[model samples]
Target: MEERIIIAGFGGQGVMAMGQLLTYSGMVEEKNVSWLPSYGPEMRGGTANCNVTISSDPVGSPVVVEATTAIVLNKPSLDKFETSVVTGGNLLINTSLIDRKSNRDDLNVYYIPANEIAIELGNVRIANMVMLGAYIEITKAISVDSVYKAFEKVFGESKAHLLPINKQALEKGAEAVKSLVNA
Candidate 1:
């Protein structure tokens, strides 16, 4: 199966990091993966977007003209990619940042308060991880355990001390969504 995911938000929001983590996770799983990110001046305060593809077979292109899922962290991102999502696709919107709802009826839209959740977790910067957790749960593109392992592997050696806090952030994110749905 092939899955194309787009994560878009303002620069410094960890949008690219999320894509990289997904790409690395796919690599660890031995799945074909590609990550294409938009860089340059636009990345400053402007929109930053990344395309991540994961499949059991070789990926043809890293650019996702049409995405199976989109995690939009801002209003512009949601407005920009909302139309390009495939039918029956998933859209995870950072409700704390984006105030509007997607008009599409064929897709599943999840309005998550990522920033709020992150803030409550004691780190507003981890809003991206909050989004990632919601995306993983909704799409099941990768296992949460796999993501945790990947997180540890990626950040463990560099700043091992931050590992626990990061893991807690991820868990808080996943738990936030779980509580929302269960409510």
Candidate 2:
């Protein structure tokens, strides 16, 4: 299956990191992957976004005009890409920053208070990881174990000490949605 995901947020919110982790995990899974980040002027607080494509076959292009899923970490990101997400696609919004919802009816939207969950998990910086977890649980793009391995690979051993916490953040995100669905 081909999956295209766009992650957008303000600078320092770990949008780029999210893309990197996804790309890394896809590679580990031996899937074709491409990560395209919007950098330079747009990254300085204006609007930061990254496109990640994971497919079983070779990826044709990295630039995504439309995506199957969008992980939006801020309101501007929600406003900017909500309308562009493919019909029947998934949108994981960081509700801590977005107060509104996409009016579209053809898509499935998830409002996850990633920042609040991350803060409760202790870092507040792992908000991206929380979103990643929700995306993984919703999309099943990669296994949870694959994500943990990717995190360890990317963060290295010294900083890898934080892997468990990051994993916990991801689990909390998944659990958050599970509760919503079960409720």
| Best candidate according to lDDT | 2
Q: Which residue pairs clash in candidate 2?
A: none
Query: Model 1, 19-107: lDDT tens per residue?
Result: 98888888888889999998667735899999999999999988898899999999999989999899999888999998888989999
Tens digit of lDDT per residue, candidate 2, span 109-177? Answer: 889999999999899999999999899888888888888778877777787888889989999999878
The per-prediction CA RMSD against the true structure, in angstroms, equals 1.9, 1.5
lDDT, each prediction: 0.84, 0.90
The TM-score that candidate 1 achieves is 0.92
Stretches of candidate 2 off by over 4 Å are: 179-183
What is the alpha-carbon lDDT for the whole of candidate 2?
Answer: 0.90
- Residue 107 in candidate 1, Cα distance off native in Å: 0.6
When summed lDDT is taken over every stretch of 10 residues in candidate 1, the lowest stretch is: 174-183
